[model samples]
Target: MTLDEDDRQRRLPAGRKAQLAAYVAETGQVTVSALAERFGVSIDTIRRDLDQLSADGVLVRTYGGAVSQSTLSRVDRAVDVRLKMEEREKEKIAVLAASLVEDGSIVMINGGTTTLAVARNLRNHRDLTVVTNSLLVPPALSPSAVRDVYVFGGAVRTLTLATIGPVSFRASGGSELDISCDLALIGVGAVSTAAGYTTSNLAEAAMMREMISRAARVAILADSSKFGRRLFAQVSELGGADYLVTDSTPPPDLLEALAENEVELITPDTREGAPEADQDPQ
Candidate 1:
């Protein structure tokens, strides 16, 4: 038997709970009964442990059991590679997301290959102010459409081309104030029904949360593949976003979860043009 399987044979309620974490990582997912059987614990005890693990971010609780928070591994890919990973899907999501931005709006966008696509799609938008932490986005935007491009200063990630730092800082004139935006276009590493929105970097998650707080409305640009997967740091719950702009429909459970959080899922329609908000997203 493997280490996790051996841990299952040992009966220590408190310690077993911790070992359950190992089992989760080893097995990826497990039912409550399975945990109880593996750990030789009571069903109620296993349930409590699952609850704790979920709270601790060690696992994502499902209806039946729990899954490892790292259900999907986050491999650091170069910007060029990421752009080619889900090119068409990113284009669809970007087009739909760009349509949500109106002219003369101040928009806040974070880093990612997907959000860069959205920046490209927003090329023709006039009198718009763009604030961002991505090194690659500003060049993708059109000069005529932009009033200004406010690039956030921070340490840049070479792999993903995103900056990690404080979302709010004192102005050059030494005035302290928070920058608010009409909308926030954020792209995250992974998303799940239970764990909500998450990313690989903790600093990015914190910065994204602060960015979300300052936005009047939030739009999360993620492809369908991101659904049901989670990364290392928790960004926010599903309710954190006002809209989820994705390439395809979410699964049934995820759809219900997004609905529960009042997040409007916006997926591309079968048409050749922009999709409307009234249509079903999932």
Candidate 2:
């Protein structure tokens, strides 16, 4: 009644084997329908593949699919884990932020997971100059056919992999950017009607505030989690932002506050094709 070696090997499921191979080829992220169609299996079978891969630490299970361990490894997981937790929502905000950028325009981007999404979506754009303090941004735009990137110099903050401190702020302040940027896409640790955008570190908050001051259009890219939360230092009052790009819907109170501040609220699907509104004619 003993099973032979070949019999034992045969017990290993074909579906699992195919999923592993697909994951290896695609570097772990694949749509469930694509995997199912590729293997002529059910959607449930692909889901099982994703579960096993996640258990093995070979990939991270995302909302619709799985992303490779290597892709997740690029950023420190402490930050990335929190980011990946809301992939679709962030990307939605990113898409809206990207639309704000014009070709051949100069822009300053802040450091955060949501800002990283904006960098990714900007790949197809051309002749754009980007000034950023985030270490993660340059690599995102590096493979693009067009794009000029400048990474601001300063003391590196390990937690977020962003450059902070006086040097970074000074460099940003000294630059005579064209139009001082068409927009500055920023990410905040927290946002409240009373406190505006805030961050945990005082120095970092100062740098962000300086960037906001210098930009022509100030767009804050925040998700629902940022709303209503307060942090250590204030970047600016909500009045500073010209627009706030977020996911589909935000909390009612926060929405009311944003409207009161006269901040333009943008969502990905609704605003993707919309033109940039006229900036305050101050």
Reference-based lDDT, each prediction: 0.83, 0.74
User: Candidate 2 — which residues are off by over 4 angstroms?
Assistant: 1-77, 142-147, 167-179, 272-282
Residue pairs with backbone atoms closer than 3 Å in model 1 (clashes): 8-38
Cα lDDT tens digits for candidate 2, 1-282: 244644444335663554455554565456778766755567887788777776666676765666676665342344545565567778778777888888888888988889988888886578888988899988877354246677777889877889985423233667744435677888887788778888777877888887887788999888876788888899889989998888866678878998999999888556757433222221
TM-score of each: 0.70, 0.66
TM-score of 2: 0.66
Which structure among the candidates has the greatest lDDT? 1
lDDT of 1 by residue, 91-194 (tens): 88888898889999999999998998888888668999999999999998889879999888789988778788888668689887668999999998777988
Candidate 2 Cα lDDT to native: 0.74
Among all windows of ten consecutive residues in candidate 1, which has the lowest summed lDDT?
273-282
Q: Model 1's lDDT to the true fold?
A: 0.83
TM-score (C-alpha) between model 1 and the true structure:
0.70
